[model samples]
Target: MQRIFAADIGGTNARFALFTGHEGSLGLDTVVWEKSADLRTAEDLLQIMQRQLQTPLAEGDMLVIALAGPTHGLRGKLTNGPLQVDLGGVGQRYGLSCCLLINDFTAQAFAALTPRGAGAKVVRGRALPDTESTQTKAVFGAGTGLGAASLVCCGGEAGFRHWLAVPSEAGHAPFAFVGAEEHAYQGFLARDLGCDMPTAENVLCGEGLSLLHYYLSGQFYYPAMVGEQVLSHDTPTLHWYARFLGRFCRQWILNTLSRGGLWIAGGIVAKNPQCVEHPAFLQELAAGGDVGGIVHATPILLTTDANSGLWGAARAGLEHLRGQTLAASAKG
Candidate 1:
């Protein structure tokens, strides 16, 4: 029996899914989730999966795990969570054929690579189509932390679409300020968080939303509570949050030069304005100085799918299978 086992592990939660079928197309077998806090280690997570799914991982299965932090080979430490895992060992323990540990955003780039509503436009304006055979795109998610990555593609056959996925730690970089408001807020963040030169993740993630809301409204509210107001587009706090996010997006787009478009995922974006044609957020996405025109030309899309990361993990599994087949054929 053959199967694909994938996990999307973030700071707060771990989502697992099993799939059956070929690389390009996969069918879901079972999916389960566990809180990272509850699970002390990666092995604990697997045990929970076995119990919840009513199935144990078996031999010849393919495994892919996406983490919120940077990854090296099949082992790495989670930047936001407490698990330091050797994903390859997990596979070997179960007599699996292959295993991979990848950055969470790396998986996200694959989601954008797949067609069929993987992304929805959040800002008004048509994305400049990929006129060049080879083009670049950016995908970033804001959650427990800000995760970023780059994708390069030279348009061609489905199986031959030469593309590269590069992971980034852009959120840890110093935050760039566009105006006095941002500068003051930066100081406030540093003071409150007790950090020096706060990073973009400080304001772009869920916790950042709460801080931003408190800074503006002087009323403290948790990130979880801010979601409803953001969805309804009913409060100044969300407006400010949107503006701040727009600035962050512009910075990343410029940094990566993702002309193919920018696709944003995670908590905030998942609840962004209903349609790209009319986004309450990112109103000034195209408003930076000098390069303002350039930013306007870059398209921005948002995904409402709560399971986007999981979808990307599944795609990761498919690509892994695809790569193995190609390698074997070449050797033969």
Candidate 2:
């Protein structure tokens, strides 16, 4: 079996796991977690990984890291935080046979393609048509910020195989308001927060929840505390805020429909099950407007499992190993 290291880095925490692969099968085992706040640089985290590895680091072992940011060139810079590192340098310093860096959303997209446990909730949208050979899929997650990606699956006599996972910074796209109320809220966000370059992420993420609440209720509150109010379901402000979130989600789903379906993962949606489960939320999403025709073609929802990123990182490492082995065998 081939051994590889994989990690998913987020704002609050970092999860690391070891994957063992043979043939086309990959198994993720010995999962571990660490606080990102405790570490300074990416290399500092690597030292911790070295200590956790069951066996000593070898030249042939691979390392794959999924970060919550955009990878410019071969380097990735964290979105909500400041941490930039070179993928090639990390590989060389760690004695890795190879190192692959991917966006957290890309990792999540790949994980959605794989068969998941009972925890994953398939909320809306149709499954990929078996007859169609290559279908494109889109993925997005809301946490520190919104992340998006596109996944393409090719089908043949061999069955469906994921071909590509493309990373995107779609969260940075300008925000669009569908109704008068939303436009009013957008104006408020711009005035209060000085949000000139507002993106959908600005009004749809965790911070967005707080902004929505303040706009609707005329009360300013911290973003972290919005969850407590959302869970109680006692506040009319939060209820309306959840509806707004659903509408924003619908917009994102429509934008991603050029692909086959849309997958929503990450802490914001997964943790606030009550908000996502609200009747108003679903109704608002189904309420058709521009691009309403495409809503039927796309799927949207909060992924249930918290370990999706870890699973995805492991899968990426295993794929990298397979590609390297295939290339080596062809050369021989």
Candidate 3:
């Protein structure tokens, strides 16, 4: 068996998991959680995790880290916070066999392949037919920031199939406004941000939730307070927020052509499921003009597990180890 160390580091929290794998099977052994603000580097967090392990990481062990940002090669920085990772340095310092870096949403995409992801609640549309199981699937959610990724099955059959997770920065794309009312809201966001244009992330995350509440009610409160109000009663702010989220999700599905399905992850909708279950959200999602039928029929799932990112990282690491083994066999 081989040792696999995986981590999912977001803006607010970082999670680590240890797995024991042989062949294609992975057994999760340990998990740890820490506040992102407390740790300055990945190594520091690793040391903390090591203290809890009966068998610490050794040579030939694999390490995979998923971060909340666009990853370039072996290095990445969190989009919503001040955490940076250099995988090469980490690998050299730990004498690991393999070290990989990926986007947090990309990790979520991989998690979709697991039983936990398969068991997600269907919030909208019907499940895809088994014949179309190979079609593309998407995952996105709002938390400290907005995140998205798509999963595709490359050419292969059953046991030999390869899955790829394509990371997306769609949250950075320009948000669109339709009517005079929404146009005014857009202006409000721009002025609040002190920028020319507002991206989806600027108006769709935790801070955005608070900002939306402020824009509508003239009360500047935190997300927790707003979330409580939304859950406690039927508020206009809740309706508007749901509508905007639904609209954004609709655009993402269309953009990615996710005919297989779409899984909603992160804290926003997961904690406040009413957002996706509301009539306004459903109506907005199904309101596509010409392709309304397609949009309406797309499967929508919500994942509430907090450890999914860590599971995804471990899965990714096992795949990497398998690929390296295959390459070495070919060379031999």
Candidate 4:
């Protein structure tokens, strides 16, 4: 059996997995988790893997990593954290024959490409449109930070296909305010952060929720409490913030309509089930004053999964292995 290593590196934690190939199907091994602070860079990550697996690294060992940052141009800088990874340098140091660096959202998009058994719940969205060729899919995830990506699929022989991951900084795009409340929050962000430009990360992410709660309630609360408060449905502030997020999600979906449908992933959304269950979440999305009609036509949040990024990284590693084999066969 062929084996490959894959990792999903986030700001707080790094999830590593091993995939074993069997009869053209991939079986996932148990996931290994490590704190990001304990492992600073890709070199440090390799050291941890080496220690855990108790094996010597070898050439032709593929490593596919999905990082929480912009992964364009062969190098990526973390958006919310202080880590820089170079694709070429990491691969060289790890003694691996192949390495693929992908945006965390791109990894999530790969997971969204194939539906898991009874895990994915289809919410509000048009069925993926049929295309003569492969279609594109978009991914949106909110957690320690906000991340987004697009995947373009290309058809191949025998019902097989390949996918290209398009890394995007869409999360960092300027946030659009619809009404007085959001405008007020935008102003608060500007005044507090000393920057007028606020992205979706500023008002819709995990930290964003805490910030919103503080701004509204005039009380300091931990980020975890914000979720608890929202889940209890006791705080109107939390509900209002959820509506804010819904509106922003609507705008994002409309902005990336070419990608067909949007898939919301990450632990933050999954943890706060009440927010997802709130009727106002969908109402706010459909209640567009001007752009609401078009935005409402686009798909909203369907379902979220915790291990989507990890699964995506594994899938990418498998794809990378297949590509390498094909390239070697062509050369021979």
Best by TM-score: 3
lDDT of 1 by residue, 86-113 (tens): 7656766776778878888888886675
- For model 4 the local lDDT of residue 39 reads 56
Global CA lDDT computed for model 3: 0.80
Clashing pairs in 4: 288-292
Cα miss at 268, model 2 (Å)?
1.6
User: What does candidate 2 score on TM?
Assistant: 0.85
Pitting candidate 1 against candidate 3, the one with the higher TM-score is 3
Model 2 residue 246 CA deviation in Å: 2.9
- Give one digit per residue, the lDDT tens place, for model 4 in 1-332: 66667778787877877766543455676567877765555667777876665554553367777888777655676665677776666666667777778888778877754433124554566554332335566777677777777777765543446677777777688877767876877899888767879887877777777777788788766778878764467477657766876776676666665335667776567677666567777787777563536565555444565566777776677666766777798999
Displacement of the residue 212 alpha carbon in candidate 2, Å: 1.5
lDDT of candidate model 4 versus the reference = 0.68
lDDT against the true structure, each candidate: 0.71, 0.68, 0.80, 0.68
Off by over 4 Å in 3: 22-25, 80-82, 127-132, 290-292
What's model 1's overall lDDT? 0.71
Please provide TM-scores, in order, for all candidate models, with all chains considered together: 0.83, 0.85, 0.91, 0.82
* Candidate 3 per-residue C-alpha lDDT over 1-332 given as tens digits, one digit per residue, 9 for 90 to 100: 98888888877888888888776666788888877876666676567656655446663389888988878888888876777777667666766767899988888987776655777888976653333277888899888788899988875446535678888889889987778998999999999999888988888888888999899989988888778775445788888888998899899889888877889996778889889888888888867673746676678999998988887788778777777777798899
Q: Give the lDDT ranking, best first.
A: 3, 1, 2, 4
How many angstroms is residue 314 displaced in model 3 relative to the true structure, after the best TM-score fit? 1.3
lDDT of 4 at 173: 81
